[model samples]
Target: MLTEKQIATETHKQKSKFVTVIHPEKLIATKTTEENNDNTFLISWLFLIGSLMFLLDGFIELSEGLSIHVLLHITASGVFTIASALFIPKK
Candidate 1:
């Protein structure tokens, strides 16, 4: 048995009790970017070392006769380089 005015007043009271808000998604994006950068840095280091080892082994094999040790080093370095290139993210 509420009047029109009473219903309106109750609606206004309920609306006043609730507030709307906005949130930014940039914070999450920034954290993700930072994590990617860290991973890229680590992978870059690994790639550089691996590339150097591969080159050194190639040079040794060229200057001297091919040995089992030199062959093993070359194979291992090649595998590391390929792995890093495939898995590393560019950020």
Candidate 2:
């Protein structure tokens, strides 16, 4: 029976037989369309979440009364929401 180490070594050798090591330049030359779509999706979701937070902050300010603390929270949330909307990519 083969030892554990010997079996592992044989498995590694077999795996390497089908492995291709492409150069960095070759990899950079490839275009990935899926990556762009995924990025767009992520940005849209971020923007949506930020908008929701902004709306929630407004509601809190209206419902709970505009104290200094509530004003600060609303201001901070608004800034973040605008920043997200501006930075995130659109589909």
Candidate 3:
């Protein structure tokens, strides 16, 4: 009768024969493509804030002056929407 500890050790040894354990560093080091896209969140947040500011500024301008700033804000909001969409991960 094998003890539980002994059985677990034997099972681990047998499983290790079929499994490969690669270190995280080694896996990252062997990547075929190096991506430099580290600022996705930063850019997204910046665009989001910029869109809000532009909208606000447009509203204030609407009270004071021309409709041009509002149009520009609408365009900027669209651009930021698309820019953030690009960074979203696909399932």
Tens-place lDDT digits, model 1, residues 1-91: 9999999999999988976665578555566767778977897878877786786777678578777877777787777777766766655
Give the TM-score (vs. native) of candidate 3: 0.38
**What lDDT does each candidate get?**
0.75, 0.78, 0.67
Compose the digit string of candidate 3's lDDT tens values, residues 20-65: 6799999777634324333555666677677667666666766776
Off by over 4 Å in 1: 1-36, 42-46
Tens-digit lDDT track of model 2 for 1-91:
9999999999999888875778999988876988877887797777869777776967667686767777777777777777777776655
- The number of the candidate with the highest lDDT is 2
Candidate of highest TM-score: 2
The better-scoring model by TM-score among 2 and 3 is: 2
Q: Clashes in model 3: which pairs?
A: none
Q: Give the least accurate 10-residue stretch of model 3, judged by summed lDDT.
A: 31-40
RMSD of each: 10.4, 8.7, 10.3
